[model samples]
Structures are given as structure tokens and as C-alpha cells.
Target chain A: MAERAYIMPIALRLWHWTNALLMILLIISGASLHFTDPVIPLIRFDIARTIHNVSGIGVSVLYIFFAVWNSATGSWRQYIPELKGLKANLDRQNYYVFVGQLKGDAPHVVPTPEQKFNAMQQLTYIGVMYIAMPVVIVTGLAFFYPELAPAQLFGFDGLLPIAVLHYVAGFGLTMFLLGHLYMGTTGTTVAGGFRMMITGWHDEHDEKPENEQP
Target chain B: MAAIKTVIWAAIGLVLLTTSAIAQIERKPIAPEDLKNIQDSNAKCLECHSEGGFDTLNREGVDKDKLRDHLVDLGVYEGSNHGRVECKACHVKGFEEFPHAADDKKQINWCDECHTRKFLRIEMQFDESVHAKEGIKEKFTCSTCHDPHVFQAAKYMNSPRDVVRQDNDFCLSCHGSDQSFEQVSKEARPDLVENHEWLPNRPLHWNAVRCVECHTPVSKKVMSHEILPAEKAEKRCVACHSADSTLRLRLYKHMVSEERSRVGFVNSMILNEAYVIGATRNVYLDLALGIFAAVVVFIIVLHSILRIIAAWVRSRRNG
Candidate 1:
């Protein structure tokens, strides 16, 4: 039997699932708005615009809760690994993905109570949540109240540059989402990662103990 | 002897100069048949009216300001819709004589005289405009905004950006310049920027759209001339930010045909002029992003397949 650990708290799990739903809504609606067409419509322009605005505002509000909750609980540490530890973890991950995976070896790191994310996961989450999310939110607010944006940015209309920034950040987050889903499969079992997120119980060992050995 | 020599030379120079000047002034007399041709008549009028040599209005001792008012850029006039119309068609009254009658100065053409049928709606709207109010009506006229010599319809212009520049120029020519605004209005000229402090990105909005988009009433016509009071102007940003932006109906009405011709895309035409955030879309960006996402998904699926195959082989070897 495998050892178990409770890593995903109920509050964290709730926030995670809600954020996921909001992100999905925002991405779909954002795509619909970007490619608005009458003939083969993705979503009606009016509806998509409303959904995007609403979801964007919702995500922004939820992000405030995330920041405050993470800070209060000291869970933000999981997302900001020490440089020395991160370098070591990253080197191991690099080798595991490139060399070890081809040799049918298991991942070099696993989620534990002390560190919820591996080095690469921590870097990506920090970027998406702390940096890219803030940028997207600020730019979205500028769009909503365009009169507030600087009249000129680098000799271009302030909204022009802000719009580009918003699109790029959104694109980065979307690509992160694609990679995150794929990486979820590389755990003790193919479904183990997904089960942990849902059940909040990480199976500490592989289904077959032999697979845990090099 | 020296005085005699100087006088002789001066007298000869004066005679020669007078003869040369007279020769320069000489011109072929217009045949009676040529008088019937509008082009010949236009050429005759342009000889004195158009900007050029030392013989036009400058030679007539007209002040610089007055000369500027009368001189028409022949190129612009030729390119205009009224290009083919004979000068005499519009200048029907006192323009025949060289020093034309002063009384006929008031014989300036009124737009309604010729544009009665085609511009009936605009004329109606203009009559109801704030500019047409009792005291201001006498000072305001069609030529105040529309220069007959260079006027071109927004539809005929190359792009929406050009249309915005041209249309805004009409309003700014008066509202934007203190000299021009004071010429028509007795009221104190308000500072345009100061008045629009509440507006976000004032310069961008001013450049992207015409003043009339907010100042004028929304209408089914290509343009509305019934200018509302400042307080009555659209204050809500959603008027233009939403999917059914009023800009589509008012400022961008001319480009509606172009947009419709694009078949599937909505608000693509607006992208050519300005990005209205939610209202505007870029198909190229969407396509590229779509392709990127598709490739990412394909890679994920391929990786998942490989992982499944590896696990199956490992399990079989263990068994």
C-alpha cells in the first residue's frame, strides 16, 4: 500500500477549481471576441463581450482573495523556491524529462506538504499568477475605462500598447494551461495527479513500487 | 557731358523696358466662338483667380488675406465632384467684368440651389442644428465647413482615417482655432482640451473619430448634421465601446458597405482606422493564436499516446 499525504487543502482546492472555471470562460470568450464573425460565429459578439468582461472582473476579484489568503497562510513560499534549491530541482527535472523519461524512469520530484510545486511548476505559476495575471488585469481595467489610460504611450495611443500587452499575457497563460494539463499525466499513475487535485490526497508512491526505483 | 550721357542711357532703358513690358502683357484675343466653351471661360476666370504669376490677384493689388480667400488650388478643384461644372454655373452673377461688381459679392452660391434633391436630409438636419439657431444662422453657411473648391464625400475618400481627418478638420477649423471660432461665434471660445478633461485619452478619441459622432444626433442617414449642445453630447463610454457601437451607425456608416463585403468578419473595418477594444477584432491575430493552440494540443495528445504505449509495454514485460 502507498503512503498518503494531504497537500491540497479544501480552501486551496476550491480556489483552484473556481479559478480554472473562470479561466476557461475567459479564454473562450476572449477567443470569440478576437475572431468575431457573423457567418460561422464562435459566440455572438455581444454575448462573448459580456462574458469576457464579467469573467475578467471575477478573476481579478478572486486574485485578490488568492493573494491575501496565500500570504496569511504562508503558502506563498511554495511558489517562490530558494535559488539554490530551485537550481538543483531544475537540473534534475531537465534530466528526468530528456533522459530519464526515455529510459522509462519516474519524475525526479513529487509534490509534498513542504513544497506543493516542483521548481519548474513554481516558476511557471509565479509568472502566470503574479506577473502575467497582474498585467492582464491592469490592461483589462484600462480597456474598460479607456479614458484613464495614458493619452500616449511611446507615441502610440496608450490603449494600443495596453491591448497588445493584454493579448500577449493572455496568450502566455493559455499556453501554460495547455502544458499544465499535459504535465498532469506524468505522476505516480496517469490519473494520479488529477485525483490528488480532486481528492486532496497525494499517493506518495507509484502504483507499482518497482517503477519508483531507477 | 556726363549728365547728357546718363540721361541718354536712362531714356533708352526706359523705352526698351516699356516696350518689353507691353510685349509681355500682349495676349491672343478670345474668339467669339471660344466664349461659348466653358473650358475657355474657366481658363479665362482661372487666369485671374488661380494662384500663379505676377498677373493674377497679386497684380490686382488684393491684400494677402483676400488673395488667399479667392485663390483656388486648380488641382483640388479639378479633383472635386463639381470639377466638370463650369465656373459660370456657380458664379452666375457679377463675375463677368475684370473688376467685378461689388454688389454681386453677395451672389455667393448657396448649397441648396443645386444640392436640393440629393442633400435634402442633410439640409433638414442642418436647419435644426445649433449652428442654425436664429442669431448664429446668418454667420453660418454651407461654405463655412464645406469648401466647395475641395469638398469630397466621405465615401469617395480613400480610407476611414482620411474621412476622420477631413470631417474633424471641419469642426476644428472653427472650434480648434481661436481666430476661426471668434469669427463666427460671439460666445467665448471654450478650451477644447480643458472641456474634455473627463474624457479618457482625449487626443486619441479626437483623432480616431469626428467631433460629430458625439455632438450630432444618431440617424439612419450617412451623417447627421443636427449638432446637439455640449451638455447634450453622449457622455457614456459604452455608446462606442459595446458591440453595437454608435460609431458603426454614425462615423463608420460609409464603411458599412466595405464591412459587409468582408462576408464573415464583424467590425473588421474599424480595425483599419482604430482599435475600439471590444468592438474591433484582428483576424490575423486570431488565426495565428488558433494555429498555435492547435499545435500545442496536437503535441499534448501525441505525448499522451506515447506515454500510454510505454506503460502498456512495461506492463506486458513485467507480466
Candidate 2:
């Protein structure tokens, strides 16, 4: 029997979709700017620059809201990996993804309100949100306002270091997105994770706990 | 015997007439109409100004280096862009007589007479320059930097490397030496290389860009001729090295059309002319990025393929 639970909130769902769309826009526009003579004419260069800057600002605002909402709702804890069960959880998830899923075995963990992300997802999210995103944002702003960047930082003069850092961080975020997209389809159904994101409800094949049984 | 004597006298008279005509053609001052057709006026001027005619020592016994300076070398002047322009075109008031009058010698040639129409914008910039602002117009004429007799457009030079070398030389002619600056201006001269020690590869930077590019405020077409004070000069590399570099906006503004400015992040296509250290895109970096992205996608695709094959094999075994 499948038990349906309301895990994602309406506000969180809106933020997620908005953030996803903005990321796509930013990536496309950013790529257009970085590659002077891009093969695909996604958009005009000037338009791309304008859109990229606007989308970057939007992402920054959304990120701030996300931080505040996560803190307020205690959902921030979901991203912090539990050190005690981390090794076991990672091993089980890896085994299910690499081996057991191919043999049609059930995944080790089910989605819960308090524990949304798995151990691996939690660790990866932490790196992306805390390290990569911040690096990209800081360096992007540095590029935008070159006067603020130090003339010489760690032997690099001017905006050279900022540009390099921004590229590296953006590249990392792209890699993370690729992994995230692939993993989204690894749930019970091909579109199961996507459906949950849209509806704020997920169906699991686990029984209701005795304490919460009605 | 009488017929022979008459023939000899006539021959002598004819020879004298031919010699006088040749002297008239060679020594005659170029008329306003004739000036337009003359190929080499500097050579005509050098006919009298060269070697024996003009003395280095003047009537007052002062070594008038300034007066002797007007003397042109036919060899050098012949090779210049200005070689074709008649001397009367620039030295308008002078040279109606054998010795030019005092007022004629003192007459200032206005560059604006011709330059105003072709380079009106640059002329306007020059009018607003610090030299003009300070009323040092007499001391800082066009001839100060550009020797009118031997000047050529830097772009038309043999190579880009020569262009850079010549452009820097134009500035260094005055600023490079303390004595030159002292002779020209009342201001104390600063050591050019020492003042620019903050910039890495100072000589390389000097070679790559014009001194006015950084020292003057940005303009529409030409770089502003108004040299800023040392403290006011642009120190940040990003001012010219960034996507919205002022160098492009001012120096290469024509290259950035309305259509192109609207199309890309960088306003101008001329950015591809040279590798702009950090501002311009790198092909090697792009290739690396492409390889990295492909590897990431390949890993995910390979893993998915393995999972699919494994699932199919298991299902077949079960069946």
C-alpha cells in the first residue's frame, strides 16, 4: 500500500520552480556572454547581458528568501548531514543506485517532512549552496563593480582573479545541476520526484507509523 | 671671318639666356597657384636653407638653434607623408621675398585651417585640452609632438608593431628627456618610467596603448588630448579591460554599431584585435570547459546506460 504525505509546502514549491527557471535563464545568458561567438544564437549579446544581470539579481533575492524561509521553518536542518548514520545511509543509497535499483529492490529511505534530503544529497547541497553559490555570487558582483575588487589579491591584480573564480564556481554549479537532474528520475516513477515538487505531496510504499495512525 | 664671329657671339648669348632661365625656374618663390602643383616644396625650400645659405650663428651672435631648426633634410622630408604638401600651404604668410620679413617669420600656422574639417572632433578635444586650458597654446603647438615635415599616420605604418613603437616615440620625444621638457615647458618633468612603476610591464603597456588613452578623459571618437594630472589618471585596468571598457567606447566607438551593441555582452567586435589579458575570452579555457561539461554528461549517461542494461538482463533472467 502507498501512503501519501504532504511534505513540500506551497511557498517552498513556488521558490523551487522560480529558482529553477531563473537558473536556466542565467546559465543560457551567461554562456552567451562568456562565449563571444556561440554557435547557437540563443539571444542577442546585449539582450543576453541585460537578462543575465537581471536574472542574477533575481536569484540573489530568491536565495535570500530561501535562506530566511529555511531558517524560519527549521527546514535548513534537512541539508545538514547526520554524522551518526551518514556512512551507512550513503552506503545504502549508493548500493540502491548502483546495484539494487537495477534488480528492482526498494530504496533504503522514504521521503519524510523532517528528513527530505538523503545523506549524499545533504552533503552535495551543502557544498553547492554554501561554497559554490557564494563564490559565484561574490565573484559576479566583483565583476559588476570592479572598483570594489582589490588591486592585488593573492598575486592577482584587477578583475582577473574574480573572473576566474566566477567561472570555476559556475562550472561547479552546472555539474551539480546535471547530477541533480539525473537523480530526480531515480525515484519510484520516472516523474515521481518532479510530481512531488509540483504538488507538495509524495506517495511512499511505507506504512503509517503507529503514533500517527488514524 | 665676320660671319664666324657673329655665329660665336650669338651662341654665347643663347647659352646665357638658357642659363638665366634655368636659374629663374629653380630659385623662383612658389606662387599660390603653383604651390598646388609642386611635388616637393621642402626640396625647393632646401635649395636656399641647406648647407651654405642659412648659418647656425645669427646676427646677434646667439647660436639660434631655433632658427636653424627650420632647415629641412631633403632625404628625410622626401620620405614623409607631408612631403607632397607645399611649404606655402603651411607657411602662408612667409616667403614672398628672398629673406622672409620679421612678422612673416613670427606668423603662427593654424592647424585648424585644414584639420578642422577632417578631424573636427579631435580639434574640439584639443581645444579643451589642458594645454589650451592653461593658455600655453604658443608653447604646445601641433608641431611639438608631430613634426609637420615628416609626420605619418601611425595606422598606415608598415606593421602594428611599428605603429606602437612610433606612437610611443611621439610621446617620449618630449617626456623621455628632462632637457626637452625644460626647453618646452616651465613645469618640472617627472621621470616617465619611474612614475609608472606601479604598473607591471610598464614598457609593454606603453608599447600597447597610447599615453593619452589613460591620461585623458574618455571621448566619443578620438582619445581626449587633455592630459590629466598624475593623481587623476586612470589607474584601474578594468576601466579599459572590462566588457564595457571605455577604450572601446572612446577609441573604437565606430566599430560598435547600434545593432552589435544590442546583440552581445561586449558592445564591440573590435575586442578581438588583441588578447586583452583578462577581459577578452580565451579559446583554451573554453575548450577546457567544454571537455569538463562533456565528462560530466558522459558519466551520467554511462551510469544510466549501465543501469538500463542491468535491468533488462535481470528481467530476461526472471522471465
C-alpha RMSD for every candidate: 16.8, 21.1
Native-structure RMSD, model 2? 21.1
lDDT (tens digit, per residue) of candidate 1 on B10-74: 87763453222101112235565654585676877787678772244445544556556687777
Q: What class would a CAPRI assessor give candidate 2's docking?
A: incorrect
- Model 2 scores a C-alpha lDDT of 0.67
Clashes of each: 1, 6
Question: Which candidate gets the maximum TM-score versus the true structure?
Answer: 1
List, residue by residue over A53-158, the lDDT tens digit for candidate 1. Answer: 8989999998999989889989788788668656766877777765576558866666777777767778889999999999999988778777666654332335
DockQ of each: 0.10, 0.08
Compose the digit string of candidate 2's lDDT tens values, residues A1-214.
Answer: 7778899899889988998888888888877666544334456555776788888888888888977887888878888877876787788778878888877776667777767777788889999988988888877776566555564332223455577678778888888888988998888777998999999998864634221101
lDDT for model 1: 0.73
Model 2 spans > 4 angstroms off: A38-40, A151-157, A207-214, B1-279, B282-284
Superposition error at B159 for model 1 (Å): 11
